[model samples]
Target chain A: MTINASKDLYAAVPDEQGRFGPYGGKFVSETLMAALAELEVVYSNLSTDKHFQQELDHDLQHYVGRPSPLYEAKRWSDSIGGARIYLKREDLNHTGAHKVNNTVGQALLAKHMGKKRVIAETGAGQHGVATATIAARLGLDCVVFMGETDIQRQALNVYRMKLLGAEVVSVTSGSRTLKDAMNEAMRDWVTNVDNTFYIIGTVAGPHPYPMLVRDFQCVIGREARAQSLAQTGRLPDALVACVGGGSNAIGLFHPFLHDESVAMYGVEAGGHGISTNQHAAPLTAGTPGVLHGNRTYLMQDSDGQIMDTHSISAGLDYPGVGPEHSWLKDIGRVNYVVANDDEALRAFHKLTKIEGIMPALETSHALAYAETLAATMTPEQTIIVNLSGRGDKDILTVAEIDGIVV
Target chain B: MSRIAGRFQQLAAQRRTALIPYIVAGDPSQDATVPLMHRMVESGADIIELGVPFSDPMSEGPVIQQAHERALANGMCLSRVLELVQEFRKSDDTTPLLLMGYANPVMYMGYKAFADAASAAGLDALITVDIPPEEVDDINAQLQRVDMDNIFLVAPTTPEERISRIAAGASGFIYYVSLKGVTGAGHLDMEEVTQRLAAIRRHSQLPLAVGFGIKDADSARAVAAVADGVVVGSALVNAMAQTLADGGNSGQAIEAVASLLGEIRQGIDSAAS
Candidate 1:
């Protein structure tokens, strides 16, 4: 599937009937149907409002420390002997990940709604931590629901949330992972419909969340565009990022979707390999279905039961990608590919040694593609990668795999 | 021997409290659920709230969520749970059985089909956690057509207008979530819940069941003192978890919890008397 880069694509969204390429539409109970209709109207008005945009811009500049750097990885680029490699450094952002950017914007929206409490769910716990941080900053009562397994594995994050004055509830249902946490979060949203705001952690869930989270996260691409232009005097030949629920990738890709000259690639983590059960490469291997909220590509068995996904990075071990990504994949604005565990691990070590940066195990998928992109093109062409997050939290898992103490 | 409302009315006229125990049918396994429910009825449970397994139950705590997940994993369909209710009806038709679950499964099964199935299965009523009375359509209409009650929730924050609207739709009873948060959160405030109940009763004459944080016998008895019924879930589900941790299956766990409910019933009975 290939999209005509010259075609006006933004109009394709919210089409004649407010549908997103058969992926997104309002499919909620009629009780809150009017509320959603009102929300849609408010969202359209607010999205285009100059004051709202100005307030958001002000926060992004001073509060979030935006326009993050674009670093040229000369050593890594030379090692691959191909394209000139540069990284859009989102890892250097406040809260140590790109998640905080979305959280800050959504929390403000919650405040605008007069919502008193914020509820969220997390998988790798990065989003949970970011949501908690913002909720604490905003002085809103925060409740985070995480899978019990994730709570145990990401113990430091759980403690961080507690320190931030958020109540952490461990979800022990379903597969005891991200999906279960999402289900539990939806339940909380339904139960506390009046005063609570569900701060969805990713570019998933029903309409508005995916679109709204993407809009908030567009800072990544907006920054990368200016930085690349200033540093290289032109746009890069290609853009690359890892997709786990696609928040980071969408953050970087939303601005560049119409760039005719630049190609885009999203690498999915294929644990062991896609042939085996231990992989999270949903775009490469899944069928279209509904879960969480909207219809999207999901890794499921023949019976439509979602499969248990496995990855060295807990963040990438999701059975589905964001619905917009599914639409984008179908339309082919971005090429979706897989990077298996071994290649990602090798890239992780390579980045640490050659670039003085240890990429998150999830981000290693993008780094793995860096080698491929660099090797395939001449040094004249440049590839800008979104370094979505730091690897500090993933050190233990990486070290355990390497049989090392540090 | 009698209609569920008649039985509840009789108990209400006698100024006695009703013992309601909840069990997630097909939890742990299907083979154990029906027998355990019967055992619960025999062990002094006056009314039973049978949990129909759902994929997502956000209002539930970890314990109840786990039980529901386990049941759903074991292939517990809404039809299968209704069949379990039918099996229970073969022996004891007097005990009121309310089917409690999230709305998706019931909606997917088609409201008319679900109501017909529930009626055929001899189930008394429904308490869909996510379905508000204002949104009641196919399911409520079908249930009413079949003469089965549709229970609605009156939360602590329910506005008076909404309360009256919910009262109009409510038939068998009203489930008033005692806490502002989800189930199994913390302690409940009796004063707040009693006030809410009074507000609800001013609009309608339906029985009210207070739940969400009724943990022990004292809490249940305290709620029963004012509310028409008490729905206990999280604590019983926690007991199931505890029993499983102690190497007992759900059948044995439910029986163990049923004995605890028996003791709680005694407390309620003595307190009411």
Candidate 2:
């Protein structure tokens, strides 16, 4: 199905109120409104400023290793015997994940805004490490809020954040997970709004944040778009990416939103299965409500209380998704599918043995869906899967799941 | 006039600062809340802010956050909170009652349905922590239809222009968050509260109620001196939590909360005297 070409989807989104068709809006406490407004003004001005663009590009090139390669998985595609599959290797970035692409941009904005302190909330710790890396480089004081549960699971990244000079605060409230950490981070920001710059990790949060983070992460799609045309002489037939808070997915999807011919698929974590309550696939199994400062598809109970989600990958365990994805799903601009834990694990093992690449468990969800999609298409069709992160941080999780002492 | 506006006007005529005491509806237990509400009104609470327990209370400090946890653990929900309001109105319908909470539960109930149900249950006003003036138009319209007041918070960080915008749409009164942090945070900053309230007064005729950091009689008196009302939340919640933590029964918890409200009332009255 082709979207109308005359609509100009990019030019009109998150309209003045930061709403993406009633999904995204500023749903924060009154304390953060001015800060969000200040951020919106600075980002709007600096986003188009030539010097700011040049500086951000410089950092993306040298510091974050931009233009992460899009490699064609010839063997894997041949084995599928359907479509040619290419991998957008965001796993090869400086932090071994696509998270750095946004952190660098936001850290620069913090410096330009003259803020001296930076704070963030992380679940799997990839975003935390990335923010810590940038804060260390900029000599800014950094504090990262991670749930006590995630701190235990992602110990290596937690230590890495500490080594990078970020004080890791362990949040122990409300299921001890990403959402709780975010609440703590918000409280901290409200308390110290004058000197603190909150670096939201994904395409979520209040206004300007969803838009700002998307702009920064769009580097992935921009690079993949150019590389696809240069190498294959056409845009890929399909794009696939895992959706947690949907930063990487939106990054890869936004640039192609205006490309009517390109199909997009966002894979959500179907923990046990979407049929069961034990899943984080909000777009698949949940209703629309407000959480974490935006109105989006959320895994909430009948009482509107957020449900505890169970995803094998800590990164994909959030009960809510980015509001833009909610909008896209409603408008039929994107197809949202789910990959259960077993399916994702099988894809993880398959990619490790067949492609000689270890993909993060979170990324494996997208790969699982891509594999299924590629098998249904003709060989002339091409698919690009966003390899959002490397699997090194998740080795221990896989080991524990297999009952192996790693 | 709405019950909230009437109560504020009554307090103003008497040259008294309204004492608004807040408690989660099902904090100690579901049965304990109605009695606590009656006790608070009898103890000179001009308004009662009953908290609706949500899974995530992002704008709350540790004390109130734990209270929400306890309330939810006891099976509290939006429907249950409304039921409690109905029960509170059984005998004492004069005291203004407000439901303070995050927006998700009410949104889940549907805006029109929630507004109608709340108005039917005798709720005077609402303070959704996350819904500022920008995103409040839809809910505000529903509230206006029901002749209910929609209160907005004017925080320490709220700019002058936004204050004007918020005050223009706000009904009942303006909630001046006395500090930049969440509920239950310390450091009242009396000077900042006094200044922000002054700035807010320039925009609208809404009465100003100062909350956050007002933990005791002295702090309540300090805020009452500069604002039309004093909202004490965490201190009362902490008293109830401590009572329950010490193995006290529901009656003891109610007594503990009412005692704190009585002292805050005394403080406010002392300031007026």
Candidate 3:
């Protein structure tokens, strides 16, 4: 289980047992173990298969609109007064976010496996919308379990999912939020394993899922790597991304891990602040324990009861991060930082005014940190911020927060 | 003798199937638990599976979910659940007690601490619904140090190779979930049960218990015809839920559940004849 720090980190990871240095492993029930094993074999075979790769590539190009452009944010960089900044335009994806990348990949897997239905648990409803979109395209029956609280906050996306022909199930469980939605989804998945595929939106579930999600999402890093060189004539000096379940962050960081020159910063949701016990910063404020499926840093109390996590953005409001992110954080390969609610709000406004790009509240956490970080770097250097999603889903939430009802 | 083995031996000697009923430890109230256990045994229960209320019981349906909510509302936790087992042992030492729940609470307490405390508290076995054989080996090793039994679940989708793998570490009898869905779901098809059990018997020498869909006396009899034991859960808890909805308390739950168990016992015995 020793990680060879000298070698390529990604290759060493998720070894035969799916351990990302004691963080990732299969911790599901017996009923799910077989399913995971089945998926592992299928994914392993298909990941290397040339036709499968080609089909995935074709879909990413024609269906999902991949190679999401890396745009240079000249105005925002000048306003910040330091390093030049570039935006990885994942917000431009068909569903207005990077979540569709992984969903398209998983829904394809479901089709390959002959599964007739797809189910997912959503937080801000972005993942739900993305999953519903893909399922609709593939003509698969889709069901989304969204927390009642989140469903209320993001009604527009909920309606979008209904338009896509997916059933939206309101979860009224503990906390009435993302974690409970996940619990209900797991329950549903365990029940309907025969003909259904549970398309986990993040890189944080049991074995093969975290690995598979990271693999599917690695396209971001892959495309960004090539795009950075083609645009800037070099790998960007630094990479910044928001970490909820850490899928988009990992997607954008994986290809750059072996490049010793690039610095990576993962900004977590510091709801109020880490010191105030109201943040969703597990890697920054919490300890390692098991939750969902894998062993990862979790925002849990001393008794192992998962604590309530908070953030203005529901997408970044999870108690646990991806297990690979935990391994990366421990190895010091990535600097894990935080941005509180106010800072993200300020960044949201700054991005909209300067760059004319309305960023999702979740992605604004990364932008907020990048604003201060760019101030310290040289002008010759560059940074790429993953604009993981658009702000369309959060307008009403923001409007209500600002006391403007409409 | 381990309580599970001893009870199975007694049941085999009498040529009767085990009628094991499940109940949440503090469903109505903690004070009502030990008495409820006694009443269930008085109505021909061979063993008792006491549910530890978890914040999320993913394998459960509406009935058991409400039972967990009620039990937690009554201040039931892992510590209190162990204390309830200690109380149950004071009067009844013969019936095997299994602490069935999810892995989080048990893991939160630390496996060694919880295992030692639960074994010392007279708990004979456990069935963590979420702890499969892969993730359970560490805890199984801990429980084995104390001679405790860690029961595993086998579903219809379980492959034979996996059944062998799960069977290796399993100490107590294997619980075969009768259907693909959660507890309190589906109607029992004895034909499917017979076929799945036949597949499971190839890899497991331990006694087999069928749960999940065994609802009434007729279904219980149908399951008991093939299984070594029939576990009835939501049916008993639903009885209590109905009684409480009717403005009744633990006294009424005791009567309703005992009556239900008595009928199931008769059905099981009659099926044997």
lDDT rank order = 2, 3, 1
lDDT of 3 by residue, B110-209 (tens): 9999989998999999998877776777898889988898899998778888888888777679899888777898767789889989988888788899
TM-score of each candidate structure, all chains considered together: 0.75, 0.99, 0.96
lDDT of 1 by residue, A1-406 (tens): 5577664675467453335686754433223333444455666778898887888788777877886789999999998889999998888877778888889888878877889899998988889989998898889999999988888777878899999999999886777788888878877775566788888888887667788888888889988888888899999999999998999999998898888788999999889898887899889998776566555788866434567888877788888888888888988788999899889999989999999998888899999987897799998999999999888887777777889986
| Better model by TM-score: candidate 1 vs candidate 2 | 2
Error of 1 at B116 (Å): 8.5
Candidate 2 lDDT over A79-176, as tens digits, reads 89999999999999998999999999999999999999999999999999999999999999999999999999999999999999999999999989
In CAPRI terms, where does candidate 3 land? medium
Q: Which pairs clash in model 3?
A: none
Instruction: Supply the global lDDT for candidate 1.
Output: 0.80
Q: List pairs with backbone clashes in candidate 1.
A: A187-B58
* Candidate 2 local lDDT, B88-177, one digit each (tens): 899997999999999999999999999999999999999999998889988998999999999899998898998988988888989999
Q: Give me the chain B TM-score of candidate 3.
A: 0.98
Model 2 regions lying over 4 Å from their true place? none
lDDT for residue B48 in candidate 3, whole number 0-100 = 96
Interface RMSD, candidates in the order listed? 5.4, 0.6, 1.8
Higher-ranked by lDDT: 2 or 3: 2
Best lDDT goes to which candidate?
2
Query: Which residue pairs overlap in candidate 2's backbone?
Result: none
Candidate 3, residue B89: lDDT: 92
